[model samples]
Target chain A: MTDASLNTASTQTGEAGFGDYFALLKPRVMTLVVFTALVGLLAAPVSVHPVVGFAAILFIAVGGGASGALNMWWDADIDAVMKRTARRPIPSGKVTGDEAFAIGMTLSAFAVVFLALATNWVAAGLLAFTIFFYVVIYSMWLKRWTPQNIVIGGAAGAFPPMIGWAAATGTVSIESVLMFALIFMWTPPHFWALALFMRSDYDEAGVPMLTVTHGRRATRVHILVYTILLAALAIGTGFTAVGGPIYLAVAVVLNVMFLIGAVRIWRRDEVMSEADNYAVEKKVFRLSLYYLFAHFGAIALEAGLAPFGFGGW
Target chain B: MSFRQEHELHKRRFGRNLGLGVILAGLVALVFGLTVVKVSNDDFSVETQASGGQN
Candidate 1:
């Protein structure tokens, strides 16, 4: 380990800034959590007051950030080893593990209690469960233990929309369950693609990613299988209440493009050079980002148009 | 930076974090206050009843 990695709460380097603390929140991931949660709230059958909706999304975002902070604290050692995550606040020596832990615990308590006050106990309960699953179940246990880590841990990411739905309706329904399933199915192909390109990072970090544990060929096959399953689920979701002409159109086009990318990835030979190998994987990873955003956007559009009788046949 | 300067910087950052905590606490208080007000108000109850009846 380098000196940077050795530095922790005992060592005093540069003073941490607000931005450093914010970085501990994993703002990029929080953005997805907030967006999906918003879609779930908006797309629900029940109508929530604008204030209530705003408050719920805010608390959900905070809860997601709290999870990120706790995950960073727990995984700082592995994070220091991974090139992709080396610059994170804790790993980079910008913040201490103790600071990250304190911030995470404080925010976790704040987000859960306030969410219960702002919305309902059901939503609060889901938020609390998401934090526990991410911090303890995924970060502490499954990540180091199994190659199927993301497969089970994906549930942590999948619960935001369900929490949002519960916040609005105070109940879980088929629509919210489908929303959860959509993300749950999409996560494997998404992360595995990144893992394929960044295999060395996981290897160095000693993370039991599928690519490290199962070999590239098996990972490729898994990606293809999961992508096909995801396509089926995504397209099937379009016929539900969350779907309409807009959502269905988006789903059909995106899933076809996604499947083609997955197939191209699966067909590539292991002997191919790094640049050529990564190009297809990178394209799939980029497409996966748009695939999610566009689907959620279409759902939001359907919800917006529902009152005009242009939504869900 | 000198040792004294670094110590001042640490103090400032601590103050900023404290400010952030206070602000967040205030937001929590505001949300709780609004929920209390809504619960006590007849208008909110009527709105809830209207929406419930529609359902």
Candidate 2:
């Protein structure tokens, strides 16, 4: 591990600022965590009080941010090497590793304890497990070990909705589990598409991403296979209690578009993808961002309509 | 500024920020403790019985 003082010494001017601290939180990732968790909370069979709902989401976001900070602290070295991550607070010398570690630990404790207080221990336990999984299991262990890192490490990201569902109902159910599976299945395709375009970053960093280890051909095959499985799971979710016409429609459209993109990616050779600067891969990655939000948004819509006769079949 | 002065300034700033963070964390913990007490005292049956009686 790089010493914090060494990092600080390397930057002769300007100490860490507020923005640097916020960057440590990875607000972009936290946004997905908050939105998906909110959907989980809202879609549960029981309704949560507005205050409790707000508090639960807030703490969950904090926990997500804590994981991000801890990840940055641990991956500062690799992050410094990866082009996509070179400008992060720690690597850019705007924040010290010690500061990030302290902040991450403090916020992790705060978020878990407050969430348990606001809702139930089940949700808190899940949140704690998520932080542990991301920081220890994923960042520290799997990231350096194997090409299947994202495949298995995706579980950390998949837990938020389940946590939210547990917060609302104090227990897990098929609906929450299905929500988790949606993200879990989506992770490989989403990230592999990114790895397709940004293959060199993983290569230079020696991170052993699938694109680096198994080659893009195998990664492409994995993406298509996962997309097929994801499409089935996503479409099937529409018939459950949480599903409605709105969710089903969104799922069908998104999955069709997603499958087409995956097929395009799978068919393309390096020459073709490079000819367009991996435009097709980039499009698939961008579409995936909307893909997840739309599915969750549709689920939220279904939950909103459940009070009337219009929601589920 | 001299090197010594700059070092002292950084030290002061770090101390201030750490103190503020600790204070904020303490406040959140206090609120969380209070919320746990309030939630535990809440009566779910009151709402259930009220709705049932009204019906």
Instruction: Please give the lDDT score for candidate 2.
Output: 0.90
Put down candidate 2 lDDT per residue, A1-313, tens digits, no spaces. Answer: 3333344345433466556788899999999999999999999998787778888998999999999999999998878777788788888777888999999999999999989988899999999999999999999999999999999999999999999999999999999999999999999999999999987788878898999888889999999999999999999999998898899999999999999999999999899999999999999999999999999999999998888867777
Question: What TM-score would chain B receive for each of the candidates shown?
Answer: 0.67, 0.64
Residues B1-55 of candidate 1: C-alpha lDDT, one tens digit per residue:
5656556788768867986898779797767766775586677889999999998
Off by over 4 Å in 2: A1-14, B1-55
- In candidate 1, which residue pairs clash? none
Alpha-carbon shift of residue A292 in model 2 (angstroms): 0.2
Find the candidate with the highest TM-score and give its number: 1
Model 2 CAPRI rating: incorrect
Q: How far is candidate 1 from the true structure (C-alpha RMSD, Å)?
A: 4.3
Deviation in angstroms for A261 in model 1? 0.3
Model 1 earns a TM-score of: 0.89
Candidate 1 per-residue lDDT over residues A1-313, each given as its tens digit: 5533553442444688778888999999999999999999999988887777888999999999999999999998888777788789887787899999999999999999988988899999999999999999999999999999999999999999999999999999999999999999999999999998886889878899998898999999999999999999999999998998889999999999999999999998567627576888999999999999999999999998899978776
Residue pairs whose backbone atoms clash in candidate 2: none
